[model samples]
Target: MKNLDYGVIGNCRTAALVSKEGSIDWLCLPDFDSPSVFTRLLDEEKGGSFAFLVSGEYVVTQTYLGNTNILSTRFEAPEGAFTVLDYMPRYRTSEKSHYLPPEVHRYLRVLYGKPKMRILYDPKMNYAGEEAVHTVFPNYIRTSSAVDAEDKIYLYSSVNFDVILSGEEFTLTDHQFFLLSYNQKLVAIDENRVLLDYERTKVYWLNWINRSREYRQYGDMVNRSMLVLKLMSYQHSGAMLAAVTTSLPESIGETRNWDYRFCWLRDASMSIDTLLHMKHQGTAERFIGFIKRILKSREDTFQIMYGIRGERELTEEILSHLAGYENSYPVRIGNAAYNQLQNDSLGYLMDVIYKYYLYFPGTLDEVEEIWEVVRNMVRMVLKSWRSPDQSIWEFRTRELNFVFSKVMSWVALDRASLIAELLHKDNYAELWRKEANGIKEEIHEKGWNEELQCFTQAYENTDHDSSLLLMQFYDFIDARDERYVKTVKAIKENLFHNGLMYRYKAEDDFGKPTSSFTICTFWLIEALFVIGETDQAREIFESMITYSNHVGLYSEDLDFETKRQLGNFPQAYSHLAFINTATLLSEEKKLSRFIRP
Candidate 1:
């Protein structure tokens, strides 16, 4: 299958509706927490997909409606032109600040000239791994099956139009455009009723978007990225997932596929920090509430990642039946990385809490309790900082003394010191400070390769890591320090590729080379800003933004040759890197005259 250029639509719960010219290639269900009834993006053959397309050659352009996540795509066909509006209703209440969900609705409208367009409505059940018995009606089609005999899923579409089901393929063609809706637990489909629901969704998104405090420059891009960040968030629990689909593959046709549909703790923390920095305190507050809730109910031990609803047991399994993306073998669902201990995640979690307290300045009993849990984590880091478990890369090879992990462990303690002083809980301030200093000294002395005049990834290793870029951003070291400047140059000289940066040499832990990570490039921009390379930073920032999908979304990695997005679609970390770096650039622009050229 050709790479379909598609946009995404979603209600706070679940999402669907992609176009064949490859726009959202239709999705609605109970929630983001629900299973897919139309998942063609993951497994095209067996995965069901809905699409709308014109016959002739066409030029496509898409953008969200202002600061909202409502996507509108315009297709200019040779004969005529048409526009498709897609949005998942934003669930909101006047009394509450959060969005919740039960049903998600997608509306498609034909604006301006109406071309003779064909609409295909195909729903594959069981992730293209199993077949379902289909029944048709005048207004809608119903498909039912107990694939694997686990749980039953039902699909109900609107009866305002006709449905044609041929074998596994379903088609819906009309002279004019029409709206089709589906959900597992939907009772009835009323065309007028659903349209009203769609309007409410649109209004809700618009209103929430308007609440954002606009930036001086890049306001539109930042807002759209923020909206995407919100869309990735699971509203019910406030856990932001890394991406919507999984098994997109890191290397095409390689067995490096993974499921990225779960909430990474580090990702959620970065999301919270970005939201707070943007003055979206309400969103940050909701996420903090989610974190506290999860920590309270579960045992002291927390996984690096969890399901959107805080699901603890995510058993990784391969969907062998479905053909992988670009034929990447053994498409896998669920993440095996959940079991690995990434010490950096703990520091990230605490760092956000510490940042919240610094900015908001309130009595956080939850923070206090979480700090106790965090103190134990600091102890874990203290015990294991020198030893390597899994580098932030989550490499499968043997672990090394990842300097970044130790740096983050230092962040955990340093921030814990601030929390201790702020909250007046005087148990471990001295000890934490001492440990933090020790780690900092070790990072500066042992972690730095004086011969190379830059910090190494680990002690006594010449290999460079993009993570060292964070040393200045995190305030681990002064931005103006010679070593930090030298390290920045080293990374720019070595990891830089086509004006972007890679995470490392991309070799396996055993040092086998891999592709460049998109997030790392953005990290370099942030580093540039901190080191007073404003023009260079802005240039790289603009260049990286161009690499996003046509709709301003980014995946985990980018193929340097093909310029194709690899790994999971719309990666949370990449967007987060965008948010953080953009914010820094915005702040720097405001104070440019005062700073040195």
Candidate 2:
């Protein structure tokens, strides 16, 4: 069964998903947004992959090296036993620079008797739009797309190129290595250099993990989620990705699939906020810098998402030729939701900026520049808070005055007011506070459903939305308030199925969602915990943890009955929620902030 049983490895430049049986299934080359080099995860026959085929007698197990991103898959059989350590080299070269590269290093170490396996090396560049011609050389094998000469990858290996290309059986009696690079290597490619790179990369991850704050409970899982988030962060532009892959269907054979390679303002902001709570300060600063760079014009309207390098126009396209994941059709590349009027994004960004003001407190000029951003966000919020638009779910068909969007618009004003007070601008703070209070009063009057005794999905409807559980999370309402407590339980009753929670049960453009949104379950757990349902919350958390793939990683959604992972792999939103909920449960106490006196 082709499941999302995969472990991700990256160097912050690019990432690859390695399946449990040792196959490089999904990988984007050179950069995260670049055309995929391996796409077998989407199309089994047409999309290409690189794998190692072993006999049926072999028992293979995969795991990540403790406290690091290096993935190790061991194969044991009566004939022999061996292990493959897969990682992308990432380590500090100097105080101000890192040696991150767009490549992967696979180190094979013999555990005992000679292991017999066949190397299956097949790569389809440019999203498998064209065939790749492989030209084998003595030291390396160069594969280039049939159409574009510039689109190429170099594979340097210690084993014979004939054995790899021909998929012939090879005997492994000693340690060997395979280095796959996007750019041709200038230095000597040998086992010794790869081994050194492996060691340094391992050490770098260990040191990075050592800096994160530890918890009394679920600490290892939190660390792993943080590492996954770090992998999705594009170091070049400081833009955080929603996921590494695109168009993995939410439900098999459903049209709910959308590309998630680019960075969403809300998703990236929430991810940075979670990392900040884990004491990873660099991500917060870098993301804020990315935001500043992209919002260069104060008049520039905020889109929900942008390319990794801050490209504004993400034209959606469908790859008609390739088969989608699990035969799901319309494999997509660019996300069209970029232009949607998602009013909720500004709130998340402003929340992060508020935290940065309190914790990071950079130089005077930097502070002023960010203050300008805060003001611009306020301006946009004030202008559009009354208008109806797409909410956090990014519905493509119709626009609604989503209750969550209104709450977040209020959050934007509230946070901006706090930022103003922090800068000691009393008049500005007072003005923003008035606007925020008006938004909140409107939500209380219109967004809440008196008949249902809870908040609805949108002001005009009585449908329950999982996102409303976050009202208390953002400090919009007290957790113990009757309305919020009722809303949480109402959403749980309506959306929670079998152990996972759906974003909403209502029908949308693609009909009702069948798969559970992974993050909504986390939100439910936290809300339940806050509402004094500690036992149930803990039980649900444990169940949710068990649903994660073998490597403790989650995708965007999971099947309601089968519990199969779906949507984009290693979704940042899912992991961010995991870290936040785990940390909240670990502490058993909420961290209250008195941003407003």
Q: Compose the digit string of candidate 1's lDDT tens values, residues 519-545.
A: 898888877877788889899888787
Superposition error at 110 for model 2 (Å): 0.3
Best candidate, lDDT-wise?
Answer: 2
**Candidate 2 regions with alpha-carbon error over 4 angstroms:** 591-597
Candidate 1: where are CA atoms >4 Å away? 1-4, 17-23, 26-35, 57-60, 75-81, 97-104, 112-114, 137-140, 146-188, 297-299, 359-368, 509-511, 589-597
lDDT of model 2 at residue 105?
92
The local distance difference test score of model 2 is 0.91
The number of the candidate with the highest TM-score is: 2
TM-score of 2: 0.99
Please, what is the TM-score per model?
0.89, 0.99
Local error of candidate 2 at 384, Å?
Answer: 0.8
lDDT of 1 at 374: 62
